[model samples]
Target: MIVYATHAGGRYLQLKDSLKEQPEGKRGVYVNLTNRCNCSCTFCLRHMKDMAEESSLWLREEPSVELVKDQLESLPWYYVSEIVFCGFGEPTMRLGDLVELLKYVKDIHPEVKTRLNTNGLSDLEYGRNTAVDFAGGILDTVSISLNASNAERYLALTRAKYGLKSYEAMLTFAEECKKYIANVVLTVVEKVENQEEIDRCKKICEARGLRLRVRTYEDK
Candidate 1:
């Protein structure tokens, strides 16, 4: 599905189904642009979960910008507190489409917040300072996966296509995001790392002037 809401079982329900299930509440509406990613992270839910055909995030084809916009426009905006660019794949894989959609969201519903859940490798992926693209009030937050404390450990966890360079590039992207996005967060998943590692990751984020968020591993 192109658009879905996070459900209790770590399963995602299509927007229409989501509305039917829980019609009222402040929730994030996630946009699935494509099933393409530049990294194969060891703990990513895409590899761990086995979803049925209807709820599967593995898209048969990437949706066009207009198609994604249509899905967003159809949603119950009153119930949505935030619109996130995230799914089975890294949203930055389609950076142009992602930004355009963010613009579209603000154009129609200026009050609804917008965010991106990314691996923080867009600079390496696009060979440019992609943070500049997020300038203006289009994006409110950028949550980047900073899975490890150092480069070697990070490379091992993410197995990013860019190799060892991926770690540094990700950190650099997070740093740059601070200048553009309002809330720049670097995240590490719990259960994947020990206390010492989490502390060390916190130091890394602090040194970079960013916040660290410990995401719970949702194994459902």
Candidate 2:
């Protein structure tokens, strides 16, 4: 799906169906830009869940920027509180397209919030500091995955293609985001890491002057 809404129990639904399920109130809408990722996290839902073809986020092929803009243009703006760039894969994998879409959202609905859920490795992916790409008020928040407390543990869990270096790069991206993004958040899955590791992660974020969120296993 190019655009969709997330429901309880980790369900992904079309906007129309989401409205039917919850007829009132605004909700965050998500865009699926691509299914390609740099990491194959051991706990990634794409590897654990089996989704039906009609509702699947696995794109048969990547959509053109114009096509995604069309979908965004037609969204039920009144019911949307936020626009999130997220999918089964890393949104930054399609960094340029993601940025264009973000700007499109801000242009059309400056009141609505915008966020990006990322692994925060675009620095390594693009061989440069990529957080600056979100400058000029295009993005409101960046939620980066802080999978583990240390480089070795992080690489072990994410199995990122960049290996041990991936952890540091992700952190650096998160820190850099603070300059451009209003909210810079780092996240760790609740059960994926124990209390001890999570505490360590908290300290890591604290030391860097970043925020941390412990997401439930089922959170998309």
Candidate 3:
């Protein structure tokens, strides 16, 4: 089920057969951009295995913008419901490439929804407000990782490069993202933290007209 795409006179193909199995209207394709990230969260599987090239996201190396464009171009048009920028790595690390790919996808399939599954450390990693860059992109949702409530607990969980600063930075980014993105969400892993943690996250998200999501810790 691999589909070939052409870009800059070069013919390239992207993997898609496995993704089509998702129920129609619930077809959410997860694209693994890279096996690189800034945070090495305890819950993250980056170090547990050869994750960059796995069954769910098959790739020897991160796909290029042209490669990603080719993959999206090969879709069955209506088989896909939502296209998520997610995988074993942080999609934002390749921000420019991702945005360009999203723009290309939206131009062709304007009805399909686009999303980013990120660790919310793009600002710290790039030393700029990354959310500001999503203004007109095809991105419909930004699902940020809100692993824990306080800084100490967060550091222990995420082992983020920036230490305690990562938590606050993510919150700030969520706030700024609400300005342009229609659906901005702060997601927390259950049990690692408690109701108090979820409550704090809700307060932060609510203050900025955003939503909070509590996802079951799947990697555990």
The whole-model lDDT of each prediction reads 0.89, 0.91, 0.74
| Native-to-model Cα distance after best TM-score fit, residue 157 in candidate 1, in Å | 0.6
Worst 10 residues of 1 by lDDT: 46-55
Each candidate structure's TM-score, on Cα atoms with residue i matched to residue i, is: 0.96, 0.96, 0.83
* Highest lDDT model number: 2
Task: Tell me how many clashing residue pairs each candidate has.
Answer: 0, 0, 0
TM-score of 1: 0.96
Q: Residue 64's C-alpha lDDT in candidate 2?
A: 95
* Segments of candidate 3 deviating more than 4 angstroms: 1-26, 47-59
**Model 3 poorest ten-residue lDDT run:** 1-10
Better of 2 and 3 by lDDT: 2
- The TM-score between candidate 3 and the true structure equals 0.83
Give one digit per residue, the lDDT tens place, for model 3 in 1-220: 1232212222122424333332334356667687678889876655544443444444567777787777777667666677788776788889998888778778888888988889899999989998878888578999998877678888998999998899899889988888778888889988667898889878876776778899875441
Candidate 2 C-alpha error for residue 71, in Å: 0.7
Candidate 2 lDDT tens digits, 70-181: 9888888999999999987789999998998999999999999999999999999999999999999999989999989999999989999998999989998998899999
